[model samples]
Target: MNSLKTVWAIAWRRFSENSAIAAEMNGRFIATVFYCTVLVPFGILSALFMDPLRIKGKPPRWLQREPVPTDMDSARRQG
Candidate 1:
């Protein structure tokens, strides 16, 4: 009877402590799924289709001097 009470007390304390950690782990798991399944793919597709979404910033001096081709043929063909 004494050992059962001790184990129950320990189990309750552990549950209280671990509940918050479990909630945080759950949040991170959800965010990871959101990024992998939705946000990242949408960002990539939108950037590919739209020009404004793609360009990060102004071109460097060398890039400005040497014109970069935008054609599909200019890009490496991988098959």
Candidate 2:
């Protein structure tokens, strides 16, 4: 059908004209982006949620919320 040819042409154009597509057609960039977005976060969250059962060493400290030192006037007030 004529529609098939037109669709193929559009697909070819998409493949050719896009600079990103021109870089890597073997899908490495896409896989890298997907791994960065999905697997890295998943790994981080998994490690955070799971307890270290003393199979190796002490568990690392979790991040704690702390107040910033906004009292810079302490030195001036003292002097």
> lDDT values of the candidates?
0.85, 0.80
What is the C-alpha lDDT profile of model 1 across 1-79, one tens digit per residue? 9999999999999998899899999999999999999999999998777677445665655533576777888687633
Task: After the best TM-score superposition of candidate 2, give how far the Cα of residue 18 lies from its true spot, in angstroms.
Answer: 13
Q: Tell me the alpha-carbon RMSD of every candidate.
A: 13.3, 13.5
Error of 1 at 79 (Å): 58
Which candidate tops TM-score?
A: 1
**Candidate 1 stretches greater than 4 Å from native:** 1-12, 53-79
Candidate 1 least-lDDT 10 residues: 55-64
Off by over 4 Å in 2: 1-26, 52-79
lDDT of 1: 0.85
lDDT of 1 at 3: 100
